[model samples]
Target chain A: MERTYVITGAASGIGKATKELLEARGARVIGADIAGSDVNVDLTTLQGRQTLVSEVERLSDGRIDAVLAVAGLSSPTVATAAVNYFGAVATLEGLRPLLAKSDSPRAVAVTSMASLMPHDDALLDAFLDGNEEAALARAAELAAGSPEQGNLIYGSSKQALSRWVRRQAPTADWAGANIPVNAVAPGVVLTPMTASLTGTEEARTQLAGMVPMPLNGFFGPESVAQLLAWLSSEENGHLCGQVIFIDGGSDAVIRGDSTW
Target chain B: MERTYVITGAASGIGKATKELLEARGARVIGADIAGSDVNVDLTTLQGRQTLVSEVERLSDGRIDAVLAVAGLSSPTVATAAVNYFGAVATLEGLRPLLAKSDSPRAVAVTSMASLMPHDDALLDAFLDGNEEAALARAAELAAGSPEQGNLIYGSSKQALSRWVRRQAPTADWAGANIPVNAVAPGVVLTPMTASLTGTEEARTQLAGMVPMPLNGFFGPESVAQLLAWLSSEENGHLCGQVIFIDGGSDAVIRGDSTW
Candidate 1:
């Protein structure tokens, strides 16, 4: 029997590409997305994520091999966090039980290139403490007042989640559990999001200029999709809690110069 | 005239040690902390940080050389971000004007060993964005009325800040502004914070076992203070945004592990 995989956000873009790639390669795939026919679960809510896990469990018939969580929103900041940050967390938490049944389960989630921003101490501590209620309160407070703060809140939420992956990685006992986890960070990708940025000339110019290495312009969805597929494969067992940057060598161009 | 310097969190621990070390070398040290009189300001609040900047400006008397933000908190996570994270940003922003006035001004901040935690693309982007208000909001949302997320917030915050520093260091234009910035990550020190950790049997056992190398237990404050002083000197111009780890070879030991 071929190994099976489950991918979220399979309705479009990278997620769709992943589904086609895996299925074409003979791996059984259970595509989960808000728009998919078989698994139309809105993963932004806990219940929706739980349902996704249940569907994957049933599809795998007691042997879901891996989960590739590409489900996310690509809006300004708040929308991004609602789906990408908390949504990913809910999906992971809900899927843990089913994944545990696999002989060599792995997971890879999607995050953005924008999370490179800076934050001071108080804000960082609140996120790291992982206090659910307080984090929500803080987010609401910041959102109640301004857009700039809300944007930072979105990025910081992702930042906290990333660090949580790293800190917990050392103690995960993944080897014993036969599970591995990792993340991927992609730079500018020409998706519907990129089209939206072009709505304003300033936004388009600024976004385009941010990339140091000209990959003829920017990466497309297919570029990121390939990387995600590999990360979700059994061939990637050794890597865990790492956010590999696939920015067409843009990050490398700043050798000795780039801070991150 | 003796070269003048400012040290916050100077009442005890690393701050106090740095102050004494600098003063011993004939440097004029202006100590500050909520617990002391030279300057009393809470770094967590914008207003408090402004007061710190104002008082430091007054005390400089047109002879300020460098600012060392060693002030930090040791609470589980939230408090750590409040002091170590926000305090650092507030102080730095507040001191920029004064630093620009100096002939060859430089600044250094302290981070923790816990910053090695992993991060995702979204979080990394958020951190690199550097919008403080947004950071606070996202932090609030993540904490979500709970306190647990705050425990791990420090590592996340530091990672984001460190990444930002790295990003900023390459082209900060601080030299043109007559100021430079740098940071250091230290391991457990023989301070009140470490002492408290020692008080807890579980923490002590866990930390003791976690020390990767044959460490000489916790490092003395002077060891780190010396590093801070050197980094702050006008001589270290090219070292901006560099986060040097001073853990008595623990980081190196981990690097050599066969696990990787």
Candidate 2:
């Protein structure tokens, strides 16, 4: 039987790569994004999220084999927190019923190595608390203030999102219901998101210094997409709530053995 | 010259214990809480935090030697996130200027072993995002919905606060300006906060089973107070952004050497 999967942020970057890979495997893909996708949804607002869910339900005939929440923002802004944290969560939770209809349901979300970076406590708290408007509002204020502030919001949003995945995975609706939920925390993947930074030697050198990728240079989107695809597969039954960092040893270097 | 210190959540629990210990050492102490203290302030609100700061500044005569943000909530509530994460943060950040005036300054916030427990992602993000209203609102909704939901909110709040302390400890205003900021995460301690849970034998047995305390049973507030005193001492200059878990080896047991 061909599986049906919903891949958000499917227009480009990791989402696009994952969508193509899954489609090649003979799966029916329902791609959702801001543009150039089978399902167009903003994912940054409550209405957008509701639309995405309704559309996915309509397209899949109320049955979804898997969901890959790969849509995200690399820059700091209120919208970053809204789309990356809330948007990803809304996609996963809102479509959970559709996923439950499948024999083997799997959900994968894209976090980042940035989750380990310093974060704004306020922004983190807002996201954790589930106040989308307030979290976005705070993120907007910080983005307008300083670059570091923006970075903090982005990092915290990812961290909180990863934590959410872990917390929800063990619950009845997920692991109990046989739905494997997990997140992929990639290091510096070379995608359109990082084009500006990796476009020049000066920027690349600076970025390289910031993240210690002992294994090799930055990763391509395909490498991360492959891991994500596997995680969203039927074989990924045993893994639940794990945030697998494919960051070329950056997480190991930074966190060491602290959170292991 | 007598050193002056400010302690929030001083009315009861860890804050009270710490206040008693500090006064015994001959430090002039200013206690703050909702009632029965030198300053009456509700830490769950911005205005309350401002009042606490202004009052501390006024009472300390413009110089504060140390600060202990020990007030916290063990139960799950929106107020838990507000008081645990925001209250502690506001107490520390709001009083930094006064701490900067001292020759040697130290700040300590009380996190909890519950931080390692499963948490709500939305609550954690809201706290980190620094949106108190949203975090509180979400927390309220969760508390009203489920008992476990409340526990999650409480745990995630402390976790986010601990993360914040670690992130802020090395900044210019902290390590650079000679003020050390850190947090102490205690496991199960016998205090007013845990009275209901630890008071009964059945509750004690259930609690013991939940947390693995390899060293012993529950800890007294004084054991935590001792660690807090050391962290807030003038002799302690090098420690920064560390959330030292003084929880009878529970942290070590749960996390193992993975995050060492």
Candidate 3:
């Protein structure tokens, strides 16, 4: 039987890469995105999330084998936290019932190496505390302040999303239901989302300084897609709530053994 | 001249212990708390935080040497995130200018072993995103759900707070002003806060299971206070933005070279 999967941000970047790879591998892929996808739904609002969940349930007939929340934003903006943290979470939680109907359900979310960067305490607090409206408003306010502030929102959103995956993995809705939930923290990947940075020599140099990729140079979307596919596969049963960093050793270089 | 220091939550627990130790070392200590203190201030509200900051500035005549954000909440409550993350941050950030007046200014906050526990993504995001109202409301909602939920809030608040300190340490207001900022993450300290857990055999066993303190049994408040004092003293110059886990090998046991 072909595995049925729902992938968000499926119109571009790593999400699109994953969708292509999964489809080529004989999986039935339902691609959701803001535009130019099978399902057109904005992930930044509660209504948008509800629309996505209902659409997935209808498309899959109330059964889903895997869910890949790959849609995300890199630049700082008011919508960054809403999209990265809440958007990803809504996909998983809202589709959880459908995943439960499957014999082997698996889920994965996209975090980023940015999670290791400095974060604003207030932003983190609002998201964790479940105040989406306030969090979004604050994120927008920060975005208006400066690009650096936006970067902070981006990093904190990824960090919080990864933490959420870890926390929820042990709960009844996930690991308890035999649905292994995990996240992938990737380094700089050559995608449309990062074209602005990779295209500019100075920006690339500055990025390299901030995150020294001890492995090869920057990664292709396919490199990260491969890892995401495996984690979301039925073969992956034991691993739960892990944020596997496929960042070409960026996390290793920055954090070192301090967190170990 | 003896250095003057302001310590919040000084009426009890780690704050009280830190105050006693600092005073014994011939430093002038200003204790702040809800009651029976040199300064009566609640750290859970913005107004409370503002009052504490203004009082300290007035008392020090705007020439204080150090600030210790030791006031914190362990149990799960809506106030946990507010007091633990925002309150501590407000203390340090609000009083930053005054500390700059000293020849060698230092600041230390009390985080906990709880930081290692599973945390809610929403709560962590809200706090880190700087959305205080939403974060507090979400925390209260979670507290209404269960104690375990409360535990998650407590742990995440500490984790976010520590991250905040790390993020701000390298900035102009701190290291640039010659003030070192750091946090102490202690494990299983024998304080009034842990009386219920340490007092019960079952709770002790459960705690041991969650965090194996291989180095020693439960520690006294003074043990943690000693570390805080050193971190806050002029003797500490080069170290900044470190959440040193003085947890008797709990962090070592749990994370174990993975983050190294």
Candidate 4:
């Protein structure tokens, strides 16, 4: 059977790599992005979510084997909260019915190592509470403050999204229906999203001090894509709710046995 | 001043190993368990939780450096739910005040690789909702059923505990007060707890079939002990809400990239 997949943020970066990998292996992927994809729709809005559901359903003939909610923002704005947390959640929830028709339905999303960073408690709470309006308002309030405050918007969005994935995986809609829903927490990848931040040696060092990946300093989109492809595969069945870190032992080196 | 530590389940297994390792390094340890330890309190009860807090405070003179909540049960009984989830939580939460007295405070607990297995949704919800009576009742109901049904109690307890550890890691008390709290999920370990299950070659093979640790196969309490000691160390500052798996390559092999 030609497995059908719907991938958000398929225009570039990790999403692009994942789309390429799955397509190369003879899978049918319906790419969705703000621009240059089969379904061009902004995922940060309610109308965008509705459009995505109808379009993906129409394109795939009302069936999808998996969903990869890879689209996200790394900026320090309310827009980051809108796209990263709210947008990703809406993408998964809205498209879940289309995915339910498959025997081996899987879902995976992208979160960041920044999830571990200190964040704004109110904004994180609002996202978890499912109040998009309040979440964006909180993000806006933080944005008008210092740079560290701005960073919290990005950090909290990623953190809340990761927590959401973990909590939702075993819920009735996903795990109860035998669909394995999970998320990937990448340390720092060399993609269009983070090129300028890690382009120079000085920038890389500074980022490394914060990220501190011991295995390989900075990897490309392909490594994360490889992992993402495997997650969305039918073979992966055991992992119910996990945020696997793919940063060359950065998790081991920095976190140590703290998590264990 | 020497660091003072409180370790539950110090009578045997991973806690005993961790206690020995930490003490050998010149730290002072106040061991606790059901029997054969400094404070022999049954942590499955509220009175036991209160006893542990008061006694540990007396032993350490109202001050402690770290808390290792290693007491747990793997049986298919309500006692397992009481001890594994509620007990470990009380061990840390009860001793947290004493830990805050130290210049370097840390907390860690032990979860299991079985946490990834299919679980009872109602029981899991009960545990998460902080309803001990309900959780135990649900566990008792499942324990009277088939072997697989009985297994869900242990799995759900561990799973719930792991989630609780993650959620609490960033909250007002632990992370807010600068106490680095985390958990470690181990695969099968050759200890008093699992000696009968993984004793013979046949039994080990059966266990391996379920666990699927591709790296070094089954591990020992010493390996987990080393990690627990590090998590309690002052050096671990970056990690929050992480459950590091010390299960050879079981997590990696089985889960693949589902979480990444």
Candidate 5:
């Protein structure tokens, strides 16, 4: 049977690649992003999240097989936390009822390998605690306090989002409903969001030092697109609450063997 | 060709189940344990690790296909750290050369869902630092100190071992050499090691409260064995430095999502 999927951040980057891959495989894809997609709405607000939920529900006729919460931000600011953590979580939770209608429902989000980097505890705690207000406040404080703290916003937001995945995947609404929710933490890809990191020779060398992708170095979105396709595919069973890293070997090089 | 595997702790529990599962599938398995296996050798000591490596090398003509470092202990003592961390690392590292000779080489070990539990930092640090003596001493101290600290022994040891897999898989010796190293973190397997936790209703209830395996609740060894087999099998190509959890949703229940 043909499957239908709702993919956020589908305008470009990994999301676009995965959307195209799924479409090529004869699946229906409803793209959602800030602009130039089926559902164009900012994900950093309650209204936008509600709009996405209602629109996706209408387009898919209230039966969505999978939801790829691929919308994310690399900015070192509070907005990153809003869109990455709260935005992603809202999209998943909202579309979950639609997902539960499918025989093989799966939810996967995009988290960055930057999640392995050092982050702010206070901001991370707020995110895990599910306090959007406090988390945003703390993110702003960190952004305004120190440059290093500002740099930590992206990592902390993604880490908190990952933790949310682990926390909610097994709950009654998800696992009890037979929905498999997971995440894919990719290393630096040559996405426009990461242009600064890979555009210059000096930037590439510095990135190599941090992520150390020994397998194939920095890769394109197509490499990660396949992994996401597999995770959402019906063939994947028994892998619950995992954040599979689709990096060349960034997780390995960074000593991310199994730190939980 | 019938793939050959060297599985430690093959006399009982998940290891034995995995050994049997592979053999039933027409795969050749060389079981290793303290007693009652093809190669009887203790895995808690450096000498034992070396002995097992040499015997497997000789038995398999120094061209072993895969090594499953399944030998582990749940005891809140220094030996748990010694066997679970140092011994396991030595076994994989020692057997890497033999594995490299195979057409498709793989390495996997047993971590636990307990890796998500709170643990001793100094002990974990010592293990990651690769200082066997210091790690053991710290483990001993924790074991002798508060009972709370003692409880962290097993978790800390397993966490360190997971870290080691992540740390080495991306390096020149593992992924760079065309070999994939990973781990499986199971939760509350009904093995002899966990008899105390699953033997009675009261114990089972307590265990559930702690680990919370909501999906099919307290699964048997065979469930995890298949996952280990896949990790060591030739089919797994892109997954490196991962500690895939086969714990029936315990990882998700414990909020252990995407943690580095």
Candidate 6:
């Protein structure tokens, strides 16, 4: 039986590539994006994600099998949380009903290597004290300051998200529910996002020099798409809640080169 | 050349015990808390922490060598962000100026094993996409209407903080800057915060059986504090932005016992 898949951010980058790959493998693919007509929706807003989820659910014909949430924005410091954090959550929550209905469901979200920034105890203590509203309120305070505040807000968000995924493994039986929730933490992928950064000679050179990759090259969206295909497949049941790295060992490369 | 240290949440539990241990070792210790004259301050509030930082700076007599941020709240699932995340950040940020004045400086924060809980990719991607505020805002949304919502908020905050510490390692130079930042991630310690969980007969029995201890049954704040002391010592310059687990082999035990 052919499976049904709902892929977000599918107009371009990893989502576009994954949509093609899944379709080639005989999967019924429903592609959604902020910029495309496959299913016009904004992932960042609650209403936008609801529309996307509703479309996916309607298109699935009652047989949705997986969700690949590849929709996200990348920035050096700011504007990341709006689309990456809230948009992704809204996507997941919106798709919950469809996921619960499926026997072998799976979900994959995109994370980054930048999630490894450092902070002091006092900062962390305050963050852990609030709920969504309080958390948002605090986030406003963090966002209100200049980006030069000497803290990587984007990295902190990813770290928190990665840890949350790790914790969710035992309770929410993604496997039992026939759902696998996994993430891909890519490092230096050459997407439209990276194109902008790489356009600058200084940024490109600096980033390339940091990686010990065979060609000193970055991974393309298709590489991450390939990983997504495997993770979303039924054969990959054992790898639930895993944060698969698709950045050609950039993590190791950076670690080896950087001295504390 | 005796050094004076300030410990927050120092009136009870790990904070109090750690204070006793440090003072016993002849380190000049000034106890601070939400309600104490030496330095009564609530780390969760920005103003409260600012006041505490000013007092600590003034009282140190020009020698506030290190701070052990043992002060925190551990409700099963309440505003961990306020007390744990933001409070820790504010406290450290406040202390940074004081630490800069000292010749050799160190700081350590206490964390929990709960932060190890697994999370999914979608969540991580959401967190990685935005600024800190955006990610935290999305985290609040993810945690809004679930029984495990508290866990989501608290664990996410700690994980965020932990990740921040790791990233800071490469850039933060304790030897060069004259200050060190590290953390202690203890597993199942006998602190007042954990007393409710471990105090009950059923809970105690279950926890005792679960302890795969190599040393004693269940390590307390004292054992963890001893390690904290070492990490905070000037001799331990190399160790920075690390979370050392003092669980009586619980991690090893879990590994050995797991069949899945």
Give the number of the best model, judged by TM-score: 5
Q: lDDT of all the models against the reference?
A: 0.64, 0.80, 0.80, 0.83, 0.85, 0.62
Please state the error at residue B136 of candidate 3 in Å.
Answer: 52
In terms of DockQ, the best-performing candidate is 5
How do the candidates rank by TM-score, highest first?
Answer: 5, 4, 3, 2, 1, 6
The digit string of per-residue lDDT tens for model 1 on A1-260 reads 57778888888877887788888889888888887546888875667877887787777786777888777765444445456666777777667677787766777777655555543244445667755555656666666656667656656655665665444433334433646566665666766655776567788687666544232345567757666766576544444445544453334334433332
Give TM-scores for every candidate, taking all chains together and pairing residue i with residue i. 0.49, 0.52, 0.53, 0.56, 0.74, 0.48
- lDDT accuracy of residue A66 in candidate 6: 83
The native-contact fraction of candidate 6 is: 0.00
**What DockQ, between 0 and 1, does each candidate earn?**
0.03, 0.02, 0.02, 0.04, 0.29, 0.01
Is 1 or 6 the stronger prediction by lDDT? Answer: 1
**Residue-wise C-alpha lDDT for candidate 5, range A1-260, written one tens digit per residue:** 99999999999999999999999999999999999999998999999999999999999999999999999988778889999999999999999999989999989988878888898889988998889999999988888977888989999988888778877778888777878788888887889899988889998998889887776567788867877887797754456778877676777766654453
* Whole-model alpha-carbon lDDT for candidate 5: 0.85
- Report lDDT (Cα) of residue A164, candidate 2: 83
User: Model 3: runs farther than 4 Å from truth?
Assistant: B1-260
Lowest lDDT sum, 10 consecutive residues, model 1 chain A, at: A251-260
Span of 10 residues, lowest total lDDT, candidate 2 chain B: B251-260
TM-score of chain A of each: 0.85, 0.98, 0.98, 0.98, 0.97, 0.83
Question: Model 3, B35: alpha-carbon shift in Å?
Answer: 70
Error of 4 at B154 (Å): 13
- Model 3: how far residue A166 lies from native, Å: 1.4
What value does the lDDT take at residue A234 in candidate 5?
Answer: 74
Residue A245 of model 5 has an lDDT of 79
Evaluate candidate 3 and give its CAPRI docking class based on DockQ.
incorrect
| Alpha-carbon shift of residue A63 in model 1 (angstroms) | 2.2
